[model samples]
Target: MFKDITPNQLFDLKQSKMTIVDVRSPKEFQDATIPGAINMPLFSDEERSVIGTIYKLEGQEAAKDLGLKICAKKLPEYIEAFKQLPQPLTVFCWRGGMRSKTVATVLDLMNIHVTKLSGGIKAYRNWIKEQLDTLPLPELFVLNGCTGSGKTHMLHTLEKEGYPVIELERMASHRGSIFGHIGRKPLNQRTFDLVLGEALLTLKNAPYIVIEGESSRIGKIKIPDRFYQHKEASHQYVIALPIAQRIELILAEYQPEIHHDQFIEAFSIIKRRIHTPVAHRIDEALKNHNYREAIRDLLDYYYDPRYRHTLNYNEEQMTTFKVTSIEDALAKLRAILPALHVF
Candidate 1:
């Protein structure tokens, strides 16, 4: 018999060599899933839709019969896939129901030691939510800068130098702006929570953490209220750089990922702030593959204007680093932090 393991047990399994298999539909796996689980979906999206329709109109028995028929031919393939995996493995479906059980049973009969998640991905999700809700976050230090100031680059530099940092943009899969959606799709809320929970758990013992300043929302995901409140009240370092240098940095970071249509779409977000003629000029620049001109124009006319007026940093909680180069900026920050006591 396959071992029936709880969600807590799944966490323990994660620390071992066992591979976590998600047997839900691929679409379901994509929307949200256990953080390190690999998708080995028992049903494709279309198959799931068909099964759902059958279940709704013809009832459970008919749906089960059809599902069995659909899956019967795939048994050899399933066995081959499972055989390739190490003997000790774990599996789950949406609710730890038939799909995972069938796989686990088949494997167990083949003398493959398989563990089935008792409550499935749903249980793991609940565990993640609870962990996030009660998460003990480190003392957060937000790194603030205007658009094009190379804040993310600075964070990466700090991380390489052994500073404790959690990149909110990486976790959310968006860079935290209108154009942030470029190059990556936003993770759904549940998936975001799982990633965030894992990050917080890893950093719980750190004395302090460096993070980027962000609004309550990053792309489609909302920051947890507690974490956001902590960021709002915590100390912050502001990085200021020459506008020309900033534009160069911004252009370098986004240029590779920019598509003509995407560049146009991003600028269109600020159409209300730009004169129609200026907007047309930006559009023409995009069409001509002159993204630098469009980037500079948008930053000057749109991002800078909006950001400059909105920043209301408290003198007591903020430190400013003004420099012409990234190295100078980082040096200033390093000098400000206590070598032994700071993270």
Candidate 2:
């Protein structure tokens, strides 16, 4: 027999051995879903639209009859797919509606017991909002720096070394810059919230979490207000690197040669903001494939000037680190973890 569980209960089972199956239409699943949940849509986009239109125009009975007809032909395929998934499973739809109920009922009849998400994805979304609003986050150790200072790389390295770290940029799929979206597809707000909520819960018991300093927005996604407030008030470690090293790091990470067209497009967006002479210089450098010169000009004229005014720390709350390389930075940071008593 299948069992029904609330959204809170489902979250409590996140560390357990189970799979979450989203049975909404493909488009619905694509829009947002629980982290790590697999898409096992009950209907294709068109089929769902037809069913919805029938329910609105012809009534529920007609829509049910059509849905039954569609399901009958697909029963064998659905059974095979469900059987292949790792179980015991938890299934959900938009509102714990017909789709999930149908899946649970059918699987049960086949002697495959499963748990149903009581109010489905909609309820889970509400739960996520509540968690973000009220959850007590661990103290944050914010890493602050200008572009190409390797803050993102440091966050991942700290995480690998057993330090709790929240990678906001990775979660948002953006680097929090004008050129942030060049090679990466940004996550919509809903997907960003989903991943962030999961990360917060996963590290709920940690002593503290290390994070890169960022503006409230990463690409188009906005950080939740409560979390951003904590980040603003946290102690910051400012990373200082030489201009030559910063340019080298940027070139290695972005590979402007491979994304030449994208770089041109990004430059177009900021053309009016930059001085005409400097902007023309960058344009000429790009056309001549002198990426290093273009990058230096942008950093010196555009990024560094903008970054200086955004620094939000006092002497008492901030520490500065001057490192020759990423490895040197990592070593210095790791050494401080012991002093901070994080271990």
Candidate 3:
């Protein structure tokens, strides 16, 4: 007889000798699931949708009956699947629902031991929420500066130089500005948090961590409330560069087709930041193919105004470093990053 287990038991077995079988739809598994779990979907996206429609349009009893028919077709395959697994195999659907139990019951009848995650992935999600919602990480040090300061470049430099840096924007396929969407597919919310959690865990054991300054949303996913608070409490630095140096860094970000489209799209994103007349002028410049004017208008009217407006001086420990040229940016970074160069 198979023993049905609670979340705690599943947790322990997962850390040791268990295979976690996620029976959610493929898309659902892609969005999020327990770390190290395999995709053994018991329902396709269409099947799940049909069952849900039945539950809503028909009734629970009818939905369950139809669901049983679907499960019956897959039951023997599921048993064969577990026959090939190592001991302490665990299975779960979205909420430890009937789909998961139906499969577990079959495995039980075959004298194969299986476990069910009580509250299933929902409970695990809540636990992660609890972990990421608290305060005082104290290890955060934010890299702050104007656009084109090469902050992401520096983050890679720092990591290569043997410092831990959380590249949230990279993980989200964003660059953390109105123009952040260039050349990246933003992770769906589930995958974003999963990667974020993994990144945080890696940095937790490090002596220090460097992360770029970004608002809560990297793309669509919000940075955890706790991680934001941690940055607020830690030290800060402004990686300053002269206008000429900034232009060089800025040009590097402009991909001819990709960044151009994104640059044009970004104006709409920050429209509320400028005076209506100024916003209208920028829009006209874009329409007329006046790219230079559009870029200048955006910098003056939007980025500068917004950055200045939101600037704060809390009790953060701050350090300022200025670079007069890209060569200087490289040198300054290299001075602290000899290890990176060697690597």
Say which candidate scores most in TM-score: 2
Model 2 accuracy (lDDT, Cα): 0.90
> Considering every candidate listed, which one attains the maximal lDDT?
2
Backbone Cα, N, C clashes tallied per candidate: 0, 0, 0
Give the clashing pairs for model 3: none
Rank candidates, lDDT, best first: 2, 1, 3
Instruction: Name the regions of candidate 1 deviating beyond 4 angstroms.
Output: 256-258, 275-281, 336-343
The residue ranges of model 2 lying beyond 4 angstroms of the native Cα positions read: 338-343
Query: Over the stretch 1-343, how does candidate 2's per-residue lDDT look in tens digits?
Result: 7899998889888779679999998898888888889998888999999999999999999999999999999999999999998888899999998999999999999988699999888899888889999889888888998899999889888877778889999999998888898789888999899889988988888878899999999989999999999999999998998889999989988889999999998889998899999999999998888999999999999999998888957889999999888888888888776444344
Q: Is candidate 2 or candidate 3 better by lDDT?
A: 2
Which of the predicted structures, 1 or 3, would earn the higher TM-score when compared with the native? 1
Q: Estimate each model's TM-score.
A: 0.90, 0.97, 0.73
Q: What is the lDDT of residue 276 in candidate 2?
A: 99
Deviation from native of the Cα of residue 56 in model 2, angstroms: 1.3
For residues 128-198, what per-residue lDDT tens digits would candidate 1 score against the true structure?
Answer: 77877787777787888889888898889888888878899988988888888877888888888888877
For residues 1-343, what per-residue lDDT tens digits would candidate 3 score against the true structure? 5556765566557657588889899988887787778878888989989999999999999999988899888878867877998876788888987867877877788888887777778876665565456412536667777777788887887677666778888878777676777667767666666667656654555656678877778767788777876776666667777655565566667653445666667778878778999899988877676756666767777776676566575644766678676556656645543242221
